[model samples]
Target: MLKQTLQQKLLQKLSPQQIQFIKLLQVPTVSLDTRIKEELEENPALEDGSLANMNEPIEDYPDKDPDEQFNSEESSFDEEFSVDEYIQEDDYKDYGGNYNGDDDEERKEIPIAIQDSFFEKLQNQLDLLALSDKNYLIGQQIIGSLDDDGYLRRPIPSLVDDLSFSQNTFVEESEVEDMLKVIQEFDPPGIGARDLQECLLIQLKKKDQENPTIVLATRVVEDYLEEFTKKHYDKIEKQLGVNSEELKDIINEILKLNPKPGDSGAVAGKQLHVIPDFHISNNDGVLHLTLNGRNAPELRVSKSYQEMFEHYEKVEKSDKKMKEAVQFVKQKLDSAKWFIDAIKQRQQTLLKTMNAIMEYQYEYFLTGDDRVLKPMILKDIADRIDMDISTVSRVANSKYVQTEFGTFLLKSFFSEAIQTDSGEEVSNKEVKKILEECIANEDKRKPLADEKLTEILKDKGYSIARRTVAKYREAMNIPVARLRKEL
Candidate 1:
């Protein structure tokens, strides 16, 4: 069934240069400096320097006369040729200048990159455990299994099977239990526990005094976890033989304990300063926007490399080695030019897209009110900016804007449209705002149920189902009516 056929089709595809431009467009000002440093390291033709000549306009280099250039295909020798001489390191040094002394005097301060992770912290603690080599390995394995929240969700039997199969080392369940008990005593007391009950109990057992509230909380977690989660206060009361006030006190104590103990120091360890990508301000009746300018340093192709390229172009063609060198220089110069051009295009695209977004959602920005936000999506922004939906999405993701009200992720302004009973279109975010207000004003003794909440919204002109109400409630981290009940 083999066949040969000639086919032709027209398609729109991004070149490597174009793709690089799009990626750069999505990177906000906060990350631009690091990105530029990475590029400088990768491409030798590109250099980090403060050259006055860098600001000069780039003109196309003239092509050399073909008669003088070497015909490489006609050559017979297999000897190697180098293009390094064409690129004079002196040119680079001149532009960057022999300012080592000047640099030292000026003291250009480069910010140190800080990096830490949850795993590294846990590994440090694992190192301190005074266990046998084999037991230490087991302890490390257990620590590795913990999730971001520091809970060990895996079962002992499953871990044992994995260890035996993967590492070819058979470990007994009893050995794992013994090692786990020691690990639970680590700085984050609840770490390496199998379940919520075990996690809470491990933390409580570490306390100096056996407080009555602590003991009661431990008992509830160990024995009445199911009832507690289900908000079955009547059943818990009968089972624990405690009054409502006593039970509330015990529940509050449990709430104060960290559910994910490993998340304590680990969270602060990796905390990054919030750098808003965009700043929004109001002047008179007009909204003003400015991209954060601190992190992004001005960049361009090193002037020395451009001069080297110009020098290579005037060389004679009969020298085959020299022609090859010229070709190499040309390629590097092209790459450098493409990168600088791409960066310029990236800045333009970002500014254009964001400007359109601000204008589109002007009401929200001006009033500093969520209710003023319209139902907007990626496609709406794409349409406004005359770009693709995917392009708009890339700009929105991982980008933040600072407003008079607060700092928010760029994507937070976008929400799906919900039709009200009066045939008016509103954002789901607006409905959530109303729901939050209703809850905040509601009497805690008899908090509204999902069905009742749905009816309340319907009365207020929003047509929503009980399930949708429940979904929104859960999204806001609000508990059910029973869970919200207080003494």
Candidate 2:
């Protein structure tokens, strides 16, 4: 049997404008222009630059009660609709006049120099090989199987299967393995190895035959790669019958080889350019922050679209086509207004959040010194700006600021507070700096261990734990003490 019951539940949903705001807030200065161009294409009512008075300040539209605007029926477009509801005389105030007239800035696009990609380089080498058409196709298939790190991650059987089904060619695993050997002999020295050990061995074996150290280096990679990686030099020396000095020479030869051979060749026009979103300038002792506006083009609602809506209002309400036209115009106009308002709001919010950040880390900005960076979090900036933490995070992500010293991601300034032995709270960044300096100055033959690093920091009044020091070291991409060892 089925029973019916009345249930009450509360639901929270984002409004269309709210959703639009969130998406816009996350777009960095480099990509904001692209987003704006997309909006312009989708909404014909939106226009670039000011069409009204240059001195007028542009005001946001849809100033009416939202409950009324959203709840109203489409039929009301014919009866109660008025163009004035969408556009007010005061809406065309600040036009951001600098973006207007012949003063519009033009940027030149420089042609990128073409270069071969990793796969193309591999294929070029494969082409030089004298093989039958079937073998040639098999070789091409092998090249396709290599990952970005220059390793053949796929199994040989899988390549054989791929050739059987996809290429309509039957081939044995032995033939694929044969061709794989040919590829592994390519210019990169380790272009098609199966693993790290093989990659190193391939490069080591490719060295000049006259070099005596190659034999020992090959043995170390082949027999005791684990010991070599763990820095157990004594064990490797005893097992290989090589003294400490001889082991050092062989180790030096191994270290000279490229681990990721595929990375050597340049790919055509694949370089990514980083554009910082904010600029910080220091004048004497004060810091000034300015948002990068190169990508954010000035925009406004099209005057023709506004006039068309007004014209539709004068048409007969009894005509269904005319009523439909009015509704369409109204929707486009509303979208244009919402989009424009969103862009302006995004600008204001970004400025507000970045200004708060610049003020909070004023000392660091003035000196470009990481040590002076105060302890701060998303909540702290959010509290200062009177905005949500998510808003601050959105600004921090994918955004970089160009300082007088260097460019930095906004998240770099934020750190957890660390309590010193003196009971004073400081940024964990300070502790990390001290730990880094200690590691840099340590003897490579017997590197400072994490326990010693912790003790050093403690002596300096940092009061950091070994585990925390390890975490910090790892965060900076520093290896453990054992891995840091060298001859």
Candidate 3:
């Protein structure tokens, strides 16, 4: 039995050019230059040039049929690739366009900072210590064991084993501990603490040792740390027999101690620098939007590539080598043209989408006020621009816009709408902002719980539930009331 069936169906697929465009759309302005440079290096037919001489037309362009030149029967590169099938030989010439790169000029190189790392500082301090060779090695071992938070995460027994096997020098944990104690007394107050408690105590001990509050603060930390952390002022008062004023002073003293000592000195990770992709300026109640020029370079097909294609097209068809050369040149020209067109299209799409966003959040842009920001999502801008939601998301994910007030990621401007008790719509960002203010102004000794936070929002006409309030608080990295409590 032979079975042949025909059914009606619709299929969707992305072409190579479309895929490339999607990838480029998501790339932020900061990294777009690097990505362009990479393309330039990989594609020989591509180049970087300025648009100053764009009016000068490309001379002697080619008109070779890729299908006839690189026929399937005569495959040259072993891969079953049809150059004609991949290339669209339409009118790719820009009769009045120029290159995207600048002319040859002096380039300035940014100088790199040469500074000692955090570990280097520790090593230098260890050198100043008057220890014997064994003790020096132990000191080095201890310093290496410290985590980025400046705490010794590794146990002394592990260090003992590390010295025994790795360094071939057997040493007791006691010796290692003793050296660790000396290193703990280094410049950074809590550089060698084993835990958070130790880290805080180390910093507090470094303060005015004769201060009476210091002793009480140390007692609070050492004996009733749990109560102090939970803001159980009454419990602490009963246990330590301290009045409100005295407890307040003791708690204030504890608060002054550094929780993360390593952060006080050199940073442990690479710092990121943000480069905004768009600029929105407010002038006399008018808003102007401009995309970063780096993202919209004046790209055009390579003139030399066009000339090469023209030269190859003139060669006799009988010459096998010349025909292959013609196919190669045609393929390169097609690629360069497609790349240039894609870049141009990307610029146009970016402007269209960003302009729509600017108009959608016009009030917020003019006032630079988060409260004025309307509830907006990807689909809102996508519908306005007549594009897919994914496309708008790509533009928003990594892009930043600089305003009169400051720079912000485009994604930050998008938020879901929340209906108020008055049946009015407000952005979830507004609710979060209000929630943050309420927490900031609450009594730290008896921090407002999430239930109370929800009630407070309700009182302000925002009908938010306790769970939703908790979710919002957690999203902002704000701790629960118990964790937020301060003695």
Best by lDDT: 2
**TM-scores of all candidate predictions against the true structure:** 0.77, 0.87, 0.83
- lDDT rank order: 2, 3, 1
Judged by TM-score relative to the true structure, which candidate is superior, 1 or 2?
2
In candidate 1, what are the lDDT values of residues 354-435, reduced to their tens digit? 8988998999999988887899999898877767787778779867889888998889989999999889999999989989
**Window of ten residues with lowest summed lDDT in model 3:** 61-70
Q: Against the true structure, candidate 3 has what lDDT? A: 0.77
lDDT of 2 by residue, 135-190 (tens): 99999998888888788999999999999999999999999998888899998789
What's the residue-level lDDT of 18 in candidate 1? 47
Q: Tell me the deviation in Å of residue 216 in model 2.
A: 2.0
Q: Model 3, range 203-222, lDDT digits (tens) per residue?
A: 88888879989988988888
lDDT of each: 0.74, 0.79, 0.77
Candidate 1 vs candidate 3, TM-score winner: 3
Overall local distance difference test of candidate 1? 0.74
Clashing pairs in 2: 56-93, 56-94, 57-93, 57-94, 58-93, 58-94, 115-268
